[model samples]
Target: MSSDDTHVGLHPDDLDLLERLGRIAAVVDPVPDEVLELGRAAFELHRADALLMSLVADAGAAVRDNGAATASHLVVFELGETSVEVEVARRGEFVRVIGVVMAADQPYAGECRVSLETSASTTTQTLDDGRFAFERVPVGLARLVLDREGDQPMRTPWFDAR
Candidate 1:
């Protein structure tokens, strides 16, 4: 076929039809508010040169015989020579998170920011020993973001913090 015979652009009718379909879909199956909020949060967390930490281990939250008074879990993430170990424990109606960062190649010498992000709140701690903690955090889906000077930020995958 000749180049002139090929049509690459969509007709005005096609565009209108797509718009109508989108409107109908939205009305029929609307996105949940939580989903939209999560989407926006995820978008905002994006970093072009950030290092995405990989989950290496997760020890499920253990329930104490005394009930929710003392439940705890551990999760670990690593990327190259850097590893982050997080331990989340139940504290009253909320939770407490303690973590330590270990980087063999590049030590976290100076103050580093460690952020614990949940659906409800975002808490940050800055320390030099690669140690950090967050207290009275609401229980929900959570992720960790580690930022060190002169280094790429590291983010952990979202995990349920029940």
Candidate 2:
């Protein structure tokens, strides 16, 4: 090892500059609390019993009460062989969730049971051609559950719909 290349500590001037940068960034680019929580939840994605799917896309929040076209959220979840796409819409005080399954490579197991798991309530529906919908759902953190035959049920991550 070269003695010239050895550095034991950060320079005082560099430390001062880093501190100033941090202060500036804290004001200009603060991280949201939800983002931090989502990042923490991402760490549990690979758990053995739970099948976690990544969000492929999202449609930003819509303006409230635009006639019958209420605010809606569309999201897609992707795993290796199975992918699910869902549309969540606000139905006055309640919610409506519509979902479709996209199976990759192998043949699908015909049908699966779909459920909406919310902190306030949980609702179930039967899938027809991998399509299901739930009406009059309550708001809160909810996930889509897919119960399969001879296999562990798949659940989408808890999504907060406030």
Q: Which candidate tops TM-score?
A: 1
**Residue-level lDDT tens digits of model 2 in 1-162:** 111223348676766787688889988998998997886576445333756677788774776574565788888887778888888888666677887887884334476787777654567777887788887777666777778877687878877554
Model 1 residue pairs with clashes: none
Clash number for each model: 0, 0
What lDDT does the true structure give each of the candidates?
Answer: 0.77, 0.72
Off by over 4 Å in 2: 1-48, 61-69, 105-109
Residue-level error in angstroms, candidate 2, position 78: 1.1
lDDT of 1 by residue, 118-154 (tens): 7656777786587888877777778888888787888
Ten contiguous residues with the weakest lDDT in model 2: 1-10
lDDT of 2: 0.72
**TM-score of candidate 2 against the unseen true structure:** 0.62
User: How close is each model in CA RMSD to the real structure?
Assistant: 15.3, 16.2
Best by lDDT: 1
Return the TM-score for each candidate structure: 0.66, 0.62
Error of 1 at 68 (Å): 5.6
